[model samples]
Target chain A: MQIQQLSVFVENKPGRLAEITEVLAAANIDIRAISVADTSDFGILRVIVDKPKEAIETLKEHGMTVSLTNVIAVGVSDHPGEFSRAVRLLADTGFDMEYMYAFISRDKGRAYVIIRTNNGQKAAETLQENGFDILSPETIYNM
Target chain B: MERYYQPEVECASREQILAWQNERLVKQVRHVWDNVPYYRKKMEEKGLTPQDIQGVNDLKKLPFLTKDDLREAYPYGLLARPLADCVRIQSTSGTTGRRVVAFYTQHDIDLWEDCCARAIVAAGGTREDVCHVCYGYGLFTGGPGLNGGSHKVGCLTLPMSSGNTERQIQFLIDLEATILCCTPSYAAYLAESIHERGLRDKIKLKAGIFGAEAWTEEMRQNIQEKLGIKAYDIYGLTETSGPGVSFECSAQTGMHINEDHFIAEIIDPETGEVLPDGEKGELVFTSITKEAFPLLRYRTRDICVLNREPCPCGRTHVKMSKPMGRSDDMLVIKGVNVFPSQIETVLLNLGMDPNYQMIVERKNNLDTLEVQVEVNETLFSDTVRNLEKIEKTIAGALQSVLGIGAKVTLMEPKSIQRSEGKAKRVIDKRNLF
Candidate 1:
């Protein structure tokens, strides 16, 4: 139930994000959800794309430093407590979440949270056992 | 205005100078041959004796001493005089490898200070001026050399070593220090600092004698314009008794070597054949008057040419052009010879700070060069694509100059280490052994 995410190293300059998006558009790869972690000098642009392997190859061909990381996507009911329950479950199990970002799927009436934790497989198992819908690569990419 | 410090020696006729050189060179060779066995063995290995060297023309017959020999000898192997006769020891900055300690007797010190005194006098220093020396003291030769030279000139000497920029400026404005002496980079920094503080008019510096590091003419112009003074270039190395081995006259041409005391030569670095005057080659020096550390035909490794044409300043000593680059510091990447100064020239011409580092590594048996350049505020604020374009521009410039491609990595401001002494500009990680 682990999903592949693309992490692109981007210097903090204008047109960087636009350049990445233009490259993805040219490659016909869709970025489903994107988040940026930024410092003064550079930023890490993390994206859950429809095609992980292809996206990585294209970005690497563009002379960008790119890496693939394993993350878990969870589908939760569109409610405040529903999001907190998944966070609370991981906290209760003593598993630390390194970072997480979420986007609401209005048509599906659910909020999908992408989480990176210390242990991906164990966190997925715990979330599944706690009555949370753990996303598969196929399901997330198809979404 | 008095141009030559020791008019009798500096303005001596060519024949007179040659006579003095031949006499001193013969004495110095015999002195080293008898006292410094380390070099005497080098002479013996070549199957030669002091009797074989009769005059300056026979200098090429002697074996050349390099930094490696200095390291091998360490402290006392090259000392030509007894310890009791030696008065002090001055060392190289030793940024590259082992430190080279040079012993100086009182007479040696006196002559060295006289060389520096000549430099100061050439730069318009006089007995009434206050000479401020900011080169590092204690082990480094710049501060001590210029300090003693300032004293010799009868100037009120301020032995202010490097750093403490604020205090340096304070004294500059307060005491009206007329002549400033330090490394070229530090002089540039002081000019920058003074300009930033709007204290240009307050600074009473009439001349600046800058050396101990390589600086471009553009930087010289920048420093001169900022400080409103004539910046004179001084040349020396610790192996040959510090700054004042040569110095620029008011003519602003090449620096005139103190040929009365040190005999200078240019040689093909690879073949060790002495190159003709005006041909760029590695510089070599033979100390004729130094009593303590009398090095004969010592290889200096600096690449430059000697000019014998009549200079406007009228000093008869042969002048050496500012060293273009060092033979040792030139980087060979992928069969292309690259000097850090070339890259620095490109960056400075592009209106960027010259702070940069060249990292070389071997990957899959191919040498790769990566130039990490610090981005100033102006460049840092540019769009990412624009920054990338700038990197590409720099890479193209470097390729055209070096005949090899290099990866340009833009680093954040203040990321590169700032050096107070000699700047370390290259990091080669290739295991060539």
Candidate 2:
């Protein structure tokens, strides 16, 4: 299963992140999980939110560069080897990953890692066949 | 004490100067009509012969020449003299466009050197002075122009072209060069280098004759203060003899246009109507004296004003103020003429969206260009590396097309401002005006 992640273009400036967060707060959009890939000049803000469609609209209205990217969310047991095993499976299968960020669930011994790979469909299938729970968009949005 | 290279002409009265212009204009008109078929055809279509253009007053009756005309008659189409008589050629820095090349005979070079000599003498040059010329040699005219002028003035000329700052400073200090000639930006860079090496006091530069690029009055003041010299502005283009047509005197009001050799006019850019003296408009020049590549009523596309106000320097020549703006969409980046259309061609050829903005800035006395393109769905990617790769690809393409590197910035969609259904193409932060 693939979930829609909001990717934002962020120029390196003071209070830019704060401005984006303030916009999300005003629109009552709760950011479920977020990861920032940064360089000295600029940064890319990848976010999973409660309402993907509304978040994209609000950010676009605020003049923010926002795009929807398809990323697979894999649920794994909250253990050190569990996270490594899923990535090792993808690596062994020669599936390249752009980036990945994790968020722990409320339930004990459980976590979801967002994986952005070259082929989302094939990677999700590979992870699903390898004894991993492929989390759906609705399940992640309600988390 | 005040000095002039040629007192007879530089200090000539209005009547004598008018007499010279009247005679030269008539002769030059006939010379062009007889030799340059390209311009002669235009004159024939207008149903005019050389006799109709009797003096400077009838100058406007002739058709105007622009860069397009120069390009059309490139290499030898507009040569009034035979190739055997031609001695050299100088060119403008135009990349991806037809390079404007001007031919010169021995006589033309002599007169051009005289113009430059007048500039040097006006800047307090003397035979005892060591003229350190760093204005770039080769086809570009700045170095050779000043080198010839310094020699005519009898100053010990150093033909050191631009760059190699360490050696430039060494020569400046050891030889104690009195006159420094280069672009205003290079002059500023030299000042910084001298200070950074803690050798400011060792520099004996008394005056700097800077040209070939646009600069602000504040930049002049800064360079003057740092180098401990008076910075004078010299104006010229390759189409018209190069870097010596006009020069600033100690009077510091404006540059006196060597009015005896060239006639300067201000015309409304849109209507082509001649504007009165002291009015700002596009500058036009008609070379009455250039033998090989004489341009008649050539439109310079530079926005400036001509002033006949009496100067304290005692030169009777009319002075032209510094060019304030351009009549068209051309940007002078690091002394290179960059047209927005040229940039557009590169982007379109590379399958990029036509919407882009050119940002010109002056950082550390150097010109920097940044091209900002709006991101479309096809251009953007979720991965930063891929997006950055696109930027690098565009930058490389621009470098090869423009012969200069530019920073490529990918802006968001619908971000570039549009006016009247057209995007504002250029945002110049140089503040040259």
Q: Specify the highest-TM-score model's number.
A: 2
lDDT tens digits, residues A1-143, model 1?
89999877666788888998899999999989999876555766889999999998998777566778899999998876999999999999989887889998756679999999889999999999989999899988988
Q: What are the per-residue Cα lDDT tens digits for candidate 2 across B308-348?
A: 98889999999999999999888888777889888788889
- Superposed Cα deviation of residue B58, candidate 2 (Å): 1.1
The backbone clash count of each candidate, in order, is: 3, 0
Q: Best by lDDT, which number?
A: 2
Q: What lDDT would candidate 1 get against the real structure?
A: 0.86
True contacts kept of each: 0.00, 0.24
Q: Please give each candidate's TM-score.
A: 0.76, 0.91
> Per-residue lDDT for B379 in model 2?
71
Superposition error at B206 for model 2 (Å): 1.0
DockQ of each: 0.19, 0.36
lDDT of 1 at A20: 81
